[model samples]
Target: MTRGLTPSVHAIWQAMGLVPPPGPLGARHDFTIEDTDLILRLAPDGQAATLEGTLGALTPDPHEATAQLRKLLRLGLGLAGFNRAALVLPDVNGADAAGAAALMALADRRPDQPPLRVTAQARIAPGDPRAAVAALEDILQWRSFARDVIPASAEPATAAAHPASPATPPDSGADFVIFQP
Candidate 1:
């Protein structure tokens, strides 16, 4: 409904090897899933999947483009007859090494299904904890809706429960507890 966005995502799904590549009407080029009049081009300025309108190489502002992408995906829920779906935020383009590795691990180990993946890394040093938290929150909200609305599958928490190595004990200091997700 939003700028013919659903099929665009489908195009991306195809491009990612999550779904088979589209026929003559679709093909991969540059970084986007291309079709006539529309494109699900990977966002170049920031994160990926920042869907935008293209006209002779002109692109909308980054924030606006991101909003449009969200709108388009929401439209898919009703039109695609999918009430619930898992989102897998691929650890592609945006994420750093740790975040990317974690997501890749999740994808590799989890069942094959549509789960949104956000590549934001929270715990990685030099990373913004807030951004990581925001990404985590987004994943939770979507998952709640999906469980209530649609039948789907997901990967188990790969990094959530794993224990980190013990920090070096301070000399003559009391024991401290470390928490992990």
Candidate 2:
């Protein structure tokens, strides 16, 4: 049996100095990438990732959303991109790493730039389909400049919607965990 692996990417990336943004301990957190305004959320288990935004320069045509999703997300990054891009570090490899760095640099030089804006047609409006998108994004706050993402330590939620959910590893304490997804 392996003796040095755990299920928490947070623990590993933190050890490697690739920190994510500050978030609640034990509670899954979200990130708003300052460079592109991409909102990323990791699954409760930290194995699956979801990226949401107004669509970037490459995703301008709504018809290309799915293709862009595949292309942009084609990075072999897994949690690496999550830690670096979200935390504003360089990914070891892949387009996202470059994008992450670009965003980080942009954040530094144009610190005042507003969150990357979605196209005009994509704007959320009353009775608009995109309204759902707006609702989802409204929950994210630029607490830390998207590039200011840092290492996260889990804090068990006092109350959870899923009471039987698996507990978050106590800091770096999940020695016996393995993620199948």
- Alpha-carbon RMSD, each predicted model: 19.4, 23.6
Give candidate 1's TM-score. 0.20
- Global local distance difference test of model 2: 0.32
| Deviating ranges (above 4 Å) for candidate 2 | 1-28, 32-34, 42-47, 57-181
Instruction: Write down the lDDT that model 1 would get.
Output: 0.33
TM-scores of all predicted structures? 0.20, 0.20
lDDT at 126 for candidate 2? 24
Candidate 2 lDDT over residue span 1-181, tens digit each: 1111122324424543667335443323333333334433443344443334322332222223234334334331342332232212234266565555444434454423222222111112222323323333332322122212211122211212455646775585767757897
Give the whole-model CA lDDT for all candidates, comma-separated: 0.33, 0.32
